[model samples]
Target: MSAAPNLVNLETVSKAYPDQVILDAVSLGVSAGQRIGVVGRNGDGKSTLLKLIARTEEPDSGRVVRTGGTTVASLGQTDTLPDASTVRSALFGDADAHEWASSPRVREVLGGLFGGLDAPSLPDGLDSRIGVLSGGERRRVDLARVLVGSADGRPASVTEGADLLLLDEPTNHLDIEGIAWLAAYLNSTKSAIVVVTHDRWFLDELCDRIWDVQGGSVFEYDGGYSAYVLARAERERQAALAEEKRQNLMRKELAWLRRGPKARTSKAKFRVDAANELIANEPPPRDAAELVSFATARLGKTVFEAHDVTVKAGDQVLLEHLDWMLGPGKRVGLVGVNGAGKTSLLRTLADATEDRRPAAGRVKVGRTVKLAWLTQHMEDLDGSWRVLESIERVAKRVQWGRKEMTAGQLAERLGFVGGRQRTLVRDLSGGQRRRLQLARLLMAEPNVLFLDEPTNDLDIETLTQLEDLLDDWPGTMIVVSHDRYFTERVADETWALLGDKRLRMLPRGIEEYLERRAEAKSDSAAPAAARAKAPSQSTIDRATQKELSKLERRLEKVEDKIAAVHADMAEFATDPGKLTELQGRLGDLERERDEIEERWMDLAD
Candidate 1:
């Protein structure tokens, strides 16, 4: 019956940098339990907007209001964890183990992000030094630190979650499974979430509202990324129709004015104004399709052939006696859990250049294949060079649909517009540098492309553009990405390395791979004998049994509420305000259900 109070509010907020005006005269609010996804091109102020909400950054003009004593937790794109500090110290400071160790939520966070306390990646568990961890491991630690909320050395019951969570590219370095876990965790949180990420599937699944930041303003759209895209397309269609009518009217007006001197003098001023208004209101033409015709070297029938390829990492065999072939124009997507040797396989294929090597068996490569490997490492780039300069090193000019594009134009097409082309590579953001690399790679016109974690630092816009570019590529492509949507978009076939010393093909794509992983995990979780037997209830006390029964009833009620919420959401699909409210209610119900389940598990144990 009452409106939810705002946790943070921005009133006529204006922020600008020396070179760019990021946000101008923007007004927005974040209420309790709101999940907002911020999406735009790189350097489009999405992260800046989050900072303003968290009060970590001040606006150049106007005011940002926050509720009294509201606690905020934020994860920036860059990891700020001290390399010298242990994971436990970075996460909980000097807090005792009893504080968070006893917390089920904290344990869940650890398990979801880092594969539990005893994960191989964390060889020393909480005591592992941050400096020893790889990039992905460090990223997970940074995320887990924010996600565990605040323990304060208190008991789990006394711990409190943040009122608002601001996440910038939170899904970075996260595998598909990890992303799913995070989505579930965030959905079950009572805290409001404002996340800036390029993962479209993540946005569509978790966010109730979408914020499109562009041209120094924030445009709000109801529902998820799909809804936002549809709304935008409809708006463009309506504008096109209006422009057509205006064009016809302007033509008529001009014709009448040209009839005679009398006709010109009759309503000349009115005609002139009308024509001017129409001309001023005319919209610019839309950009052409991203990918254009590029001359690719002809590929022979034998693009790449693997004969009894057995690849290994140390003693861990990744591929065992595997025979495979990559034909000309074959597009493949490689996916597996972290540490599952996807990168190893990619390198093995790329390295089979000179001979059918004895070390890893035989892999025959076609002679005409010009291979381009876009690796995750940005170290390949010379930071001192400008964006355009780096691209020009590959080629000064490229063919685009019967037209030539200078290195600068090619850079702009890849998202380095005007002044950005002049910026030093070292000064560019992670995403900018990725785009620059892609531009350079495309300039080479390689017939075969090997992309490893290509979506690492790219925005959704850039990802979409890259997909468009790849759509028309007349070459063999092998992509390894954690972003599901991008992989599905670019690759025609999906393959998985499930850590079983095999490279398996999945006809149904990622869905099938996930099912197989789920089945394997389930099978490996317990022995057949244990799974066949039920836990005895004789150990439970009368009071505990009663509590368990009550929890079961509560869970049933919660399930009903969930079903009802889903129906309400579907019914109010056209009403954004009502849909947002319903989404919040659903999240609360889900959280309640999860708490009840956890309590039940505790009681049974």
Candidate 2:
């Protein structure tokens, strides 16, 4: 294959603030139409690099070179729309410029964007003010604006359209469907994209190259996120092998030098001197692993129980008629689309219900169960506070003992250090703030922990560490996440918030639940297709009967397992060892029964 065209290049780039350097002598190149993902631990200057490219921030030294006159557009955490501007004006420049607003094509586009939901009437007819929109709604409007501007509309020149897009955490407020749509759109486009995100699945699916910024340097890998991981592991393995060989050679040289004067010839003396010099010059291997420890306490058998619970905000019902019983060691995952009230439900369970009361039923929390909550937005922590001071404050509030830990120490545990703790939370990177939030959450010795999108802004290593930590945690957990990999690895049960104020409990995880739901949907649609292709009534009936029989056999197998589990329970107390084995078998059987029964119900519907 021919070499790819270099679209953007950074030469000897270095950024510094006061005495600390964020990026030092970093140089990299992006080829045309290359989808590059930038990843690193929080505060590693991944965002800084993007800023330098987008010209949002200037570097202390070095230059960014673009081979082509590619117009770049960057979307940041904060929306840049004027306070009083309407959505249409913010996107299309002005009402007069947006001639497409009156066209039927525009309405069709808007309908598609909103997933065929009824478009809320623009109060002033596309001139409605934006100040009244909710934060999530504003983000959606911002995205819509970008999409329209990039397409044929006001500011319609081809040159005005973005050739390169820099998106930092674009999925921040997006739901599952929105994220999927964005991914599909990006994949279908030829725009050179540089995205800074902590979503592994997004990076894996969209990026053609990976740029890892770590320890004041950038390492470029010519592959996807998973390939980058494999490359890093292999590099570490090779380094380890080389270090071992050097150490062995040094040991042998030292042993020879320790022999008598007979071994101290000119050659022997030179070899000894070389060995000593090599040993002195050798640097220790980098200790890259992060060790995060949370002093979480264990709870009693019964953690929490809710019966016929209804949670609502004002008159809006989030979830109703729900009965949930969580044991001491259950790890539950709350999975749903955005605005599905996952956060509200979690807050209700966490007893942050002073503003909104439970409509009906009772919530009984275990006496010894202490709850720790991590909100989706880390804005709960004071932005002006230093990282260490924030952790210290949380430690004090939680009554942690007088063995005060420095911010550096806490950050080191979270895989961050090097003057980052001294930086204000406002100045800290997104990942840095996330780590600080996690550190603060860990300081609370809660047996039941609730996390809202905890995987956001986390690196693969950090994610792995979190999984290990959660695995070792003897606490009940309710994690709200859109990450399928994380949910599959960490959760034992899944709760989905379907529309119409309904919630369903799935025994399996998000992946299995989605699979079963898809299968059921296909099954439900097949009869209509069969009817359309009917040759005769008798032939159609025969085909339908065969299909029904296949389904019945599957149902019978599930019923047989349920019946077998009941029969096996009758012999649970016969013998000591045999009873223990039978009891374990019965538990497995019960879990299987629940999964099968749930799927069967969906199929029946």
Candidate 3:
């Protein structure tokens, strides 16, 4: 193992806005091939540090030094692409004059996106104007920019395909497939990275170090996200112990200070000052965040039932012949390709379940059904409304058991600060607006939630916090998220939407669903030589036949014994010792039955 060279360094840098302190004399260093993750709450200078390293912004004090030859590429959280710029122009820049126009590296980066779901051999929609593209589309183009070392499709220069990459919330618009691709790239690439993302899986898999930004300073921790969690908890524990010691010393100091003036002298002046300083510098009591749990209106027995539901967009069938029932406390996660009708099915289900209306079919809902649909596109939120006003419009109050709070109070629990609550929706950042949307939904307090991509634009800390809320939620939820981790964590079952608009029920869970798909692909794509290499069916059948014959006889004997045990148990039901003995034998027979059944399936496969 060899040490990586230093790429960039920040020397006692501090950045501040007119009214708020962002970073306070924070020093950080980036090394070649280092994978660093920057994590903090919103508006906590995570992005500020990135911009400084990216050279897009400068700190008010101190300097950000970099190696003279180092090249850097930055993908910002917000899009500053010119409205007139086309996606092709933004990513491919000016490569026409150079050999870089057909660079395979560029092609390789784009090919991995969405697993060629778009163009099999080349990227698509590059000609679309940046202003006209959807949020997710624009995000893909941004990812392509840094991945290829240029914002515009231009020939890669040393600076273009930079020595270092700075990405803020890079996973904002990505799908599960896209995230997996990125995780693989970052883990493999030798280029240094300083990224701010809320995706736990990304950080856990790729990051070698974590820069935990809080209170205007970075607490550097070795290893990845899981290591950071442990390190942070230990730091807190140590701080608690030190505070306890200080409290005890303070009591003695107070008692001594209250004694007669004879106890005070010129020599003791330093002690008096030290005591006062200790009182002033003592850390305040920990202000833990409030746990979010909402009171739900009672759901009637029949939550909602959809019969023969059909939904179509233009001539494309998004859903067909769907019969679904959403019962109380049920959770379902919807997953599919980017343009797949996951959202369409979610909306259609909301109509059938809550509005009691379904296109081309009869749908019914319980008398007390309360439905809330959280759309992926949050454009319906009034841009002019203050964050608090938006929550107020949804509902004025939220209740959980005997505890209750106004919409404003609940907004704070959702990570909305005092100033942010007063900020207009249009003025908020992408992550902030997403938080606002979450706050509004919580205010609604619906018994059934329809959340489409709720994990989008959320910071990792906030994302986990939202998961905590979802875990405790006692409601029927249909969540459509590209985040497989979040979906697995919160969903009770997975519902998959295949290419043909057919819905597959997954009571077996998402992992099994993916496994079956992989196995099917393997069987279909297996070469003849690979297939022929296996034991002949005749050979397998002969051996299995012999074993099957013996197993059948053994099974019959086990069954006869099981029957005898059942009869004996009934006869000895009043005798504790005999009943226990018979029951234990019955359990052994059941285990044998399971083992034999497993062997039978293996032979069949």
Candidate 4:
């Protein structure tokens, strides 16, 4: 018999920098065909683990074992393509056989990867240099290389052979169609994959498991992103309960020892001594409580208005003939492809000084509208300033009444405790900087808040906290984010910028909008064969029956697990270390049950 494959196994892994420990005694196993999503806040060693597994970086002390013939590839944050390489040449090179380029299988993969972009005929030939391509185009080129694989050594027929594939935010620069295509491709691949992403919808759709790296250790959950979230919340709840019980027991033991008279029996005295020792040695829980709060100020009835507005930057039109009105407590989201001038429109609206002239239109603002803007680049902050000092300065400049509190106190409230408050702004991680910027926003107490890419690099916990804060926000808010979950939760309406300086307002959520766009695209691009083979009513009925059968089978399995919670708990009690394991499993089952039921209802409809 062939030896079993170990997709990934790390033994006694330990990695450390000079000043901090990134991972300590961390061990994890990923089996074949498993799709795992790795998540953590910035600077939590998530990327480091990926590097170790891909052999890009080595662990300080540990053994990383990969099964025989396993191939792994990682798409890192930075593009790894050469400067002068074009998309086609980057994938196949100049000397590769032309037949491979014309292959139907190759064309299919290319079409899926690039959203049906014409692969055969290029405006510029394959010899065209990559230096001229835009950022988004470059990313697509690099991704195409990976999808095509090595052409010289391996025959072009060798496709779908990736044993393991790692992607770090593959959807970073993709548009809606590109993202949909990428999702479908990943789902269809047989590769065992690990993805680190902030996109919750992508994670929910692609990953089978979640590996959360936190506090120098990894927590594994056998479910997708949503299941991981519920499991984590439940674990925190259990931990709080456990701590409370321990405290109560300690209090009771201390009271008994103090109240009892000198015991006549030696056994009673010994027991009292042991109890005191146990109480004295008990350690506090590792995690600290955070007092996170964000409240928005009230605004006037008419927040802002724009009439025949045209925004331009250096003679280039960003938005033309635009008319908009903002009301009190309105929540809006702005979305567009990269370089589509979303940021330019925002700048024109937030132009307080009127230094630059508007392009052929008028924009109006309410007299009492207090606006605060969070830019994507974070240029307003000074690198020399300490984290706490930034918050203090914002509070003082805004003339907020709560300026009496020390900088330390403010920092603590924003989840920056210990020596982190004194850390220079330049030293903070991406997530920390974002949080500090948010802290400044809270201090200003703006009636209208404009946030750009607010969820970038934020962990699930921070994202949850932000969602809660925004849910209760009283201000008229406008946000620009590609994160579907954030947009769905916070946005009441969406403004999508189409080409030619045009904007369309969509009342429905992002997912609905994407679905509609997909349908429209399909309707517009229907092939002759598809039209000819249009299904009859009977055929449609048969297809629906088949889908319903599959849905019913899935629902039945989910129901069976829901009925076996007691059995799961009994199995959980078998081992002391399995307590956490059991809790995670139970959470996964419950979430699956809910999702299956929802899907079943939809299928029935």
3 or 4: which has the higher lDDT?
3
The candidate 3 region of ten consecutive residues with least summed lDDT is 284-293
Clash number by candidate, in order: 0, 0, 10, 0
Model 3 agreement with the true structure over 208-325: per-residue lDDT tens digits: 7999888788899876665565455446546773354334433323332323123122112124454444345433221111211222246756676778887654333567887878
Q: List the candidate numbers ranked by lDDT, top first.
A: 1, 3, 4, 2
TM-score computed on alpha carbons, candidate 1:
0.74
Candidate lDDT scores, in order, read 0.73, 0.62, 0.67, 0.64
Return the clash pairs for model 1, or none. Answer: none
Off by over 4 Å in 4: 1-5, 94-99, 102-109, 112-126, 131-135, 150-158, 241-297, 310-321, 337-341, 352-361, 380-382, 396-415, 500-502, 519-605
Model 4 is weakest, by summed lDDT over 10 consecutive residues, at 285-294
* Candidate 3 TM-score to native: 0.69
Superior candidate under lDDT, 1 versus 2: 1
TM-score of 2: 0.65
Candidate 4 global lDDT = 0.64
After superposition, which runs of candidate 3 have C-alpha atoms over 4 Å from their true positions? 79-104, 114-135, 151-154, 157-161, 241-297, 353-361, 379-396, 401-408, 417-430, 507-605
lDDT of 4 by residue, 1-605 (tens): 66536788889899999877889988987677788889877678888888878778888999889877777666777776677666665666554656465665456566755433244222233444678765756676666655555422332233454577777778876665576677777787677788888776677677778998887899887666655654554465457733553344334323333332222111121244644544455332111111111122345456667789886544335678988887776778887644456777777778732434467777777777777888677655788999888888877433222234454554554458798899999988887888898878867767778888888667755675566455445667788887765775566688876545777787665655576666655765576234223433234476665765555455445544433333334333335456566566667867876886676456545
In terms of lDDT, which candidate is stronger, 1 or 3?
A: 1
Residue 312 deviation, candidate 2, in Å?
Answer: 3.2
The digit string of per-residue lDDT tens for model 1 on 1-605 reads 88877988999999999989999999999988888999988778999998888777899999999888667878887877889999988888788878777777787887787555433236356778999887877988878777777422221232767778889999987888788779889988888899999987788778889898987989888776655554444454457733543344333323322332241233222334534443454322212222212322367677888899887543335677888988877789999865566776776777777453524678888888888999877757777998888888989987643466688876765777678788998888877877887898888878888998888778876776566556556777899888976787677789998868788889888878878988997886577335223233357677877787667556655665565455455344447788778778878988998999899778767
Q: Per-prediction TM-score, please? A: 0.74, 0.65, 0.69, 0.69
